[model samples]
Target: MRCFIFVVFLSSVAAWSEPFRPWLIAAYGDTTNQTDRYQMGNDNTVIDIYTNLMWESGFLNVSTINLANKNCVSLFKNGYSDWRVPTVHEIQSLLDYVNAPGINEDYFTSLPSNESVLVTSSSSLQPTDLVLVVQQQTRSISSQYPPDMNVRCVRGPQRTAPLDRYTKFQYADKNFVKDQATGIGWMTESSAIWFCDQAVDLSQVWTPTIKALFSLFNQSNSPLIDEAVFSLPSMLYLGSSTPVAGENGYLWAIDGSTGLFQTVPLLGPAMAYCATVQLD
Candidate 1:
C-alpha cells in the first residue's frame, strides 16, 4: 500500500468566506501546446507518447484497492506485464478540460461511466479514512469508498519534464498567507482587475490568459509543479481570469487536488499567484 502523510476531507472545498476553485501554481515559463501526444493501442488501451504511459481502459471490475493492485500484478495485457494501478495524478492528466465528464473519449476505447468513480494507488494521510479519487473533470479526496469503484491500470515509467518549461515565480510559504500559494481563500475577478490596473509586474498571476494558467499543470505529468517546494495537502482550487469560449458569465477554475478544470461564476472564488517577494 502507498502510505501518504496528507489527508483532506471533502469539506475542504467549501470555504469560510467563499468556495475558492482550486488550481496548482507553478514557477517557470513557456508552455507547449499538448495537442498531439497520443496514439491508439490494442486491447482497448491508449498510449501517451510524451509520458510513455500505456493506459488500459479496462482490467476493470474491481472494487477494493487491494484487489485492484493484485489484478495488475498478476495480469498481462497487450504484450506487457508491468501494469500497476495509476496514481491519482496520472489519471488527472487524462482529463479533457474542453470536454464534459473530463476525459478524452477519442483515444481511450472504454472508461467508467460518468457515475462511476475511479480510485488510484495513492493513500491519504489516514490511509483507511481516505483515498485519492478521479471522475469526470475533477480529482477529489473522498472518505467513503463507492460500493463499485473502478480501477484502471497503467504501465511504464513516470515521465517528468525538466524545470525550464514553466515561468519562474517565488511565493511565501503557505503558512501565514493563504492567498495565492495555498489557493485556500477567495479571490475574484475584481481582485484581478485591481492587480491589472495597478500595473504590478506579476499582475497577471491571478487573471492570466488561459494559456498562461494551463501552462502550470500542462507542463508536468505529476499534479504538482515542484514537489520539493510545495506539499500536496496545502494546495487548493484556483480561479483564472480566462473566460470560457461559449459560456457567458462563466470563468474557468481548476481543482488543485483533482486537476479538474471547469467553469464557475465570475464572482466566485479562486486563488492563484507566483511572485519573487513574500506575500504580505
Candidate 2:
C-alpha cells in the first residue's frame, strides 16, 4: 500500500512540475547573430519571438497609408519579399512598457528617445482619412488624419489560442467567466457605473468599485468558492488592441489617455469589464 501511494505521489509531482503554457522561444528563423530574445537578421529585418513575425526595423517618413503599404512591398529582406503593416493587436503585443525601447531592444536596437508613432493596419473609428497611431513606448492609440505616422512592416500569421475572449462557466452555483487567453476570471452579473468622460483621479478611479464588488462576491456563503476578490483589468486585457468594434466591445481602460481615458458616445457605449487573476 505504501509503495503504491509513493508511486502516485511521484506521478502527481511530475504532472504539477510540467509547464502550463508554451513561452516565447528564440530560434534562428526567429532570431539572428546568435543572440537571445531577438537579433537582427541580414538586411534591415528583425525576427521577433512572440508573434513569429519578421519586422522591418527601419523608420520611414511616409506621406499616406497607401504609400506606406507600397513601401513595404517594394523592399526585400533576408531573401524574402513578403512584408506588410502590422495590425493594432500585433503592435500592442510587441509593446513592452517596462523595457527601454518599449519593444525587444536587441532586435529594435536604435529606436529614438522622442515619441515615435507608427501606423497600424486599422482604419479610422469614425471613417475618415484618419488612421490609428500607436505610440512606441507608452500606451497611446491616437488617430492621425492625412496618415502621417511612420510605418513598420510585419509578415507572419498571428498566433493565438482558439478560445473566446470571455468563456462563461459556473462555480459554486455562481456565474463566472474566464478570459481564455489571459486566464482572468470575472463575475458575469457584476459591473460598475463608471462613465468614460468622467475625469477621475489616478488612485481613486477604479479602487472603490473594485473593493465593493470584491466584498459582494465574498459575501456569498459558498464553501466551494473562496478568495473572491476582484480587480480592474488593464486596457490591454479588455480588447484595447483590437481595432474593429464588435459585440464584445471596449471596456474602461487605465491606459491610452492622458487623464481619465474617454470612450465614444459618452457613457452609453462604454461597458465595465472587471477581471481578476484566477487562483488554483
Candidate 3:
C-alpha cells in the first residue's frame, strides 16, 4: 500500500541500476534501510518484506517447463491464487552463492536435500529447446527432458527488468556508447588479461554476476554481448561479485563461451572486460 525508493547494494555487482534495482534491491536488501527481508507468512509461504512479494517456500518437482507452469498457477496456496513461475533473475535473487544449496536457509527452510536445479520462466537461446536453471551455478537444461527440476512460485505485481531500453548515447568523447537503463559503460577488450589488483589502472573493476549476465548480456543470437560493442572472447573473465565463504579476494570464473561460471582459483589471466559504475 506504499512505495519506497531504495538503493540495492549488490556486494560485487555494479552493472544493475534504476528499474531493475527496485526489484533487485529486494533480493540483496537495502543497505540504506536494512531489515529482515524474508519472514514466515501463511502456510508454505515466505514473505519478502522488502519486495512486497510472497514466495512459495514449498517447492514442486516437475519434469517439464509446461508442468512447472501449470502447477504454480492452478494450485491455491493460503488463499492466494496469483502464483506463477519465476524468471531466472527472480530465482537468482534468492541464491546465497557462498552456501551449499545456495539459498538462505534462515527463512527458506524447506530446501530439498538433493541436488536439483530450479525452473525459471525465461527461455534460453532456442525457445522451447533449452530452459535455464538457477542454483549455485546456472546451466542450460533440456526444456522437455529435464530431470524433475524444482519450481518455486511467486505472487506479486509482475514487472520485468527494463533491460530492453538500451539506448546508445554519446557524451563528449568518453563513454560514447552506454546502456542507458543501467549507468554502466562497457569497456571492450580482446585477449588481454587482468587481475583484481589491476583496478588501480582501470576506472573501476567489477566482477560480473550470473544474475547481471542473465539480465543484460544473454542474447538470442550468436554473440553473448552486443557485437557492435564487442566480439567477446570465450575465455574465463577475471573477478566475480560472489566470493566463496572463507576465501578472501577469490571468485568464480565466468566462461565467456557459454556464460557458465564456477568457483575456482584464478583461472590464469582471464580476458578482462571493464564497466565503470555511474551512480545516480
On TM-score, the leading prediction is: 3
Error of 1 at 271 (Å): 1.9
Give per-residue CA lDDT, model 1, range 1-280, as digits (tens).
Answer: 3212111111111112222222232211112124676677877777775445678864366656667767666657787766766654455456544455445566653343444445543321111223644444332323334556556677655333333323333432222123332232222222332253244454433345332344344212454344433333333656555555457777666666655565667665555533222211
- lDDT (tens digit, per residue) of candidate 2 on 166-224: 56676445466664543445555324335211324212122122111211211113321
Candidate 2, superposed: residue stretches over 4 Å from native: 1-36, 109-111, 123-130, 158-166, 171-174, 177-280
Which runs of model 1 end up more than 4 angstroms from their true locations? 1-35, 110-114, 122-130, 137-144, 159-237, 240-264, 274-280
TM-score of 1: 0.54
Report the number of clashing residue pairs per model: 17, 0, 0
Q: Work out the TM-score per prediction.
A: 0.54, 0.50, 0.66
Q: Write the per-residue lDDT of candidate 3 for residues 200-239, one digit (tens) a residue.
A: 5544544444344444445334565566766566655533
Model 1, CA-based lDDT: 0.45
Give the whole-model CA lDDT for all candidates, comma-separated.
0.45, 0.40, 0.48
TM-score comparison, 2 vs 3, better candidate: 3
